[model samples]
Structures are given as structure tokens and as C-alpha cells.
Target: MFRVQKLLVFEFEAIYEPVLVEGPVVLVDAQGNGLRQYHMALTSRNVVFSCDNLFKNSTRRGPSDEPSWEGRGQDPEIECLELVSLVPLECLRFNFYRRGDRCLMMLSAHQAHQHLNVKEPMIFEFGGHNFKHHFWYTWRERVASIRVVQPRYSEITGSSPFSSSDVQLEEELTVQVQVHPRPIRSSSGIFVRCYSSSGEGY
Candidate 1:
């Protein structure tokens, strides 16, 4: 029984490790209808996304640890895109969006990993507020949270998933998202994984 418990624990750890979804984060409008989605996979130096297959209907919890060689995974046809403009050793700024009772999040700019195309920069936004600690610290901290959110624009109500509406941004909510890697940092803390950038997260 003890050995069986140990085995079960190992399997549980494998299945529900500390990680976000490798699946699309589904998003519905305020009325809750057929909505859009965004698949985000963050790394230490880069935040990647699968651009080939957007607006999927699936909503998975945690990422799968199964080896892809076995021919089973979510969005196998997904085309990976690297927002190759992040330096995990710098400060990442944050912005909050709120309208009365409705609150949202949008994060922009990085102090360290700034490699974005000047013409088209990607803004990371979340659907809600209250989780500022997830991104409000240096990357070298003992643990950091990587959150995935579906952006709901105020003007657009169940329109194109990627519609560019007039953005009403608010005051800056700053967060120290990166720092110099320390020698004594624990290996068991938060780790990120994305295509081409594997191993413990930044």
C-alpha cells in the first residue's frame, strides 16, 4: 500500500505539476457566446504563442507532460510564435483597466528582454484583476506566477476575435518582473516551458 501510494503521488505530480495550460484559453464576451481564444506559452526569455490555430473551442487546465512522440497532444497542428522580445532579467511594467465594477488587465513594456518589432508590438492582457502578484516581481524571485487570460474589449461585443478596437487604457500598475539570476535560487520554484525554449522556466 505504501508503494502504491508513492506511485500514485508520482503520477499525480506528473499530471498536475505547477504549470499553466498548453491549450487555448477560451474567451466569451460579456453575454457569453461564441468567443475568441489566445494560446500563450511563456519562457524565461521569451513568451511564445501558437498563431496557426487560434480561437479554439477547447479549455484545458494544466499542460500535458506526455511525450509528443506518442502522437497525442493538444493542437498538434499549432504554429508556434515567439514574442522574442522578453528579457527575464529586467522590469516588466503593468497597466490596469477598470470601468466601475468591470476590471481588466493589460501589461506592456519590459526593462530587460526588449526585442519586439517596433512596428507591431504584442500587448499581454488579462481578463480580470486581483492577481497582480503573479507578475509584480522580479523574475529571479523564489516563485512567480504566469497567468493566461482572455481579453474582453469593451467596445467589441462578440465580434472578430482579433478586432482592433479603440483601447481605453488607464494608469500604470508597475511590477518588477525580472532580476539578476542568483546562485542560491531554488530549482523547485516556478518554471516556464514553451516551444523551442524548454527546461525549467526563467
Candidate 2:
């Protein structure tokens, strides 16, 4: 539903070379159809980036009888990409009502070092859906060695049912990479998520 309507890029200076900072946030809808609402908040020790549903019925024209029915519903899936240092960070929230019913939200990042002449797809599956996307970053640090760490999960609200000692039921996938030093951009492939049922319960 909420496909990337557009992509705007910008650059800024960080305090430290290869700054120890939380990676940028990129949200993509798994369902890929219908109108869905989104709310996001990004903040650091000093810098704060916050925004709520950027696209809603308020900005669009609806049917005359129901002027508010701006096709803002849910999507089969939605994709959101947020650049941390961008100026219009607050405006990234929007409705993918046309296909918002079944959506998959994804958050991933790439470091400048890993973004060289790499052309392969990375896929993630969650909530009965398989979401896909690519990664690209430019390296500027002169130090031959750099470290990049991405969080496993952005937010955790409640505890899980499984315990540490219990037998693990899920499968894990591993990837091998070659490192290099240069300004590189890595492109990930398109993400897809399939659902057997519709509506918002997940």
C-alpha cells in the first residue's frame, strides 16, 4: 500500500569520525497494499526527530458524499525509509490506505564500509510475511579499521513466551561478506511479504 512515493537524500556532519550512533531507521510495509497509518520518533542525547502519520485523509480529496473518505485505509504492505539527518523528517509519515490492510514494517541500515560494489538482495521475514529491501552507504572515514553495529530490534514492548533454556524453534541464516576501503554504495533488492488473511490483528 504505502510504497516509496519518493526518496530525498541529504548529507550532514557528525561529531566523531565513524560516530558511535544508532543507525538510521527504515520502515517498510510487509503487506504492500491498502492504507495504513504510521508514527515514528527518533532522538539522541541532544538531537531529536519526531513525526506522526504524515499522510492522512486531511491532505487528499475524497468522495463528495463522504469527503473524508480519502482512500486512507490499510495496505497489503507499506515501505518507509527515514534518513536521520534530513530536514523534513517530520513529513515522512503518510497513509498507504489503498493497500494498508496487510503491511510489514522493516528497519535496517548499512555502513559506509560495507557499501562497495555489492549487488545482492537481503530478505527478512516476520509476522507471516517476507519483506525485502536493499542497503547502501558511503564510507568517508580514513582509518583503515571501522566498526558498525546494528540493533537486532528497534523496540520491544512485552516479554516473549519462549525462555532461554527452551529448545529454539526458529531457523537462522548467515551471510559472509568481504571488506574493502572506498566510498561505496550497496543496493539491496526489493522486499516482498505475503499474507494468507487480511485485516489488522498482527
Candidate 3:
């Protein structure tokens, strides 16, 4: 009984050792209809999606001290794995949201074929409050590291930048007008107007 329990524990650890997050993901359409279902495993190097067979061929032998069962005598050299899609480390865009107890992550890149893309993004749904929090911080740091700087010519020329609507006259001038009173037939009235070439008028 002790040997049997030890063998089972060893097999479990080996299968999940390299996985960061493993859960069911659904590829949905524009109308939010599920197009397909896949079991996904997120590792540091790749996002592996498996269909039909998951962990079916992951059986291996334990240590020599642990007695093996009848079928577990020799370790198999070749194993069968069926994968639907495998996304590489160049996943450019990452977006995620939490709905109730499940979390959904969307991964996309410059080209749709390089990463997972659909009419509606593939919704990676997983449970557990702590796992959701951990996934958020890990991916947020990755996305934040890529900084895109927009070129500004003003910075190189050492001048303040202004918009088209913010333009103003380069210089200002003051004009002085002297008004002299002149006598008319009944009432005396005189008005003097002055203009300056610098754009000031009186």
C-alpha cells in the first residue's frame, strides 16, 4: 500500500511540475457561442492546448525502492500527445478579466496566427481567488515592461510645442493718440484715430 501511494504521488508531481496554470478554455464566436473546448496548460515557454488526450500518456516509473505494479514495470520511451494549438513565447498582447469566481485571459500578437485569436477571444476560465490574483500580477508586469515612446521633435530642438489653435502674434506694440478739441457751429467735437505697424491701434 505504501509503494502504491508513492508511485501515484510521483506521477502527479511530474505531470504538473512545469505547468503554471492549467484549466479549461473555450473558444467563443462573435455571439459568445462556444466554438470548441480545450484543456490548456500555460508554461513559461508556451501555451499548450490539448484536446481528447490529456495526461493519458504521462505515466512513468517511480524510484527503484518503490515497488511498481504489474503494468508499470518498464518506463515507456515514447508517449502520445494530441495538441490543438501551441502558442510560443512571443504572445504580444494580454488581457484578462474576472467574472464572479472565474478568470478569463486573452492572448494575441502582431499576427493572428502567432497567437490565439478569434471573433471573440478564447476565454480561459479558472477558479480560485488566490490563483486569479497571482495571474493578474504576473501578466501585468510582463505587459508593463514593453514601453512605446512617441517621437517628439520639440524635445530635440529645445522649443516648446504649441498647437495650431494656440498661435499668437510674435510682437506687441503700444500707440499713443493725442486728441485736440475743435469748435463747430453749435457743439465742438473731435475724434483722433491712431495705428501702429506693430499691430496696436487706438
Candidate 4:
């Protein structure tokens, strides 16, 4: 059988690493009871935010037909929000290890602020001391984008898998944004790790 197959392809036309303005920030989704983590990866061109909400266990009728929420059958929901456009803000990081306290600073409010909501106190342990702090996002940094997928429709009198007349080429570059949030801060500026999981610095 000789027939045409609607094999289409699409990929990132171009990708550029963003400048290190301030980064590896870990924000928590205050809107959710679970308080999911939203990691921040800052670049000159964009600020990529990603999160993974993997439920350890899901409730489902198991082999015994009994409902179970103890690591049964389900996968965690994952998503990412990227801003092609970006803006520089008055971002600051501080760590009082000796005092056992820390603080977060973001002069320009963006969507990441929701996770680090300043309205409520974010209390935790830092520098071996219990610390409590608040954050506020005056503005939400969001960019609008649309994605669509469809079968490639074309007409060819005779098309087969053996046909070599036409060819579709594709190139891919998988960028795994590595996020690292250091608890300690220095007097100079942002505290970036030297040996990250990827062993590559941006």
C-alpha cells in the first residue's frame, strides 16, 4: 500500500539563555493547600518558572476493589509558565545565619509573587534559626502564548514511505533548567552554587 502519511514537525525555532539577574528562587503556591513549589530560572530574554506536583499516592479502586490513597494509581500534575518578555527589578537576597534569619526582596511584582505571597508570613528554619518573613508581588508578570497541533494535510498523486523526493528535517535542543535555592547569602550579591546538578552555570 502506497499512501501519504501526515507526519508533521515543529520545534523551538530559537532559544537563548537569560542573563543572571537573580535566580534559583523557590516560591510556594499560597493559593493551594499543599503549597506547591514554583522554581524560578532567570535569564536576560525570559524568566522560566516550572513546578511539579507529584502526589506520592493517589486514591483509586485497587486490585481488591478497595479505595486507596496510599501511593496507588496516579501521576502528579506538572506544568510550566514562561515569560518571553522580561523586566529587571530591585531584587535582593539576605541571610543572617548567625542571627538565624533570612529575607526576600523583589521590587517588581510578577506572577512568581503568588507563590511567595507577602501578605502572609513565610516562616521556616534558616542558618540554624527559626525565621519568618513576608513577600509581596505588586504586579503579575505574564506573557500570552498559544499552541496548536493538527495533522498536516497535503495532496500527492503517489506518496509512499520509500519516496525520497521530499524530506522533513527537525532539530531539537533540550534545555533542562536547573534550579538551586541556597539558604545562605553573602554581602556581595546572589549566592549561586558552583557545582550544580548539571555542572553548568548560566
Ordered by lDDT, highest first, the candidates read 3, 1, 4, 2
- Enumerate clash totals for all models, in the order shown: 6, 53, 0, 7
lDDT pick, better of 1 and 2: 1
Q: Model 1, range 22-80, lDDT digits (tens) per residue? A: 22322234333324334443343233333332223334444653223233343334312
Question: What's the lDDT for residue 140 in model 4?
Answer: 12
Which segments of candidate 2 are over 4 A away from where they belong?
Answer: 1-128, 131-169, 174-202
lDDT of each: 0.29, 0.22, 0.37, 0.24
Candidate numbers sorted by TM-score from highest down: 3, 1, 4, 2
In the range 52-156, model 3's lDDT, one tens digit per residue, is 432444443543343323364433321222445555544433555545444455544435343233323344444334554444434333233322121321121
lDDT of 4 at 176: 32
Q: What is the C-alpha RMSD of each candidate to the true structure, in Å?
A: 15.1, 16.9, 34.3, 23.5
Clashes of 1: 6
Candidate 3: C-alpha lDDT = 0.37
What is the C-alpha lDDT profile of model 2 across 1-202, one tens digit per residue? Answer: 1122111111111211122121222233343432322222222111122223333323434444322334555332221233223211111111111123232222222232132221221111212123221111111011001211212221210111122432222333422222212223343333222111111232
**What TM-score does each of the candidates earn?**
0.27, 0.19, 0.37, 0.24
Candidate 4 residue lDDT tens string, 23-94: 223332222122323334334223333333232233444555544345433221211122222222212111
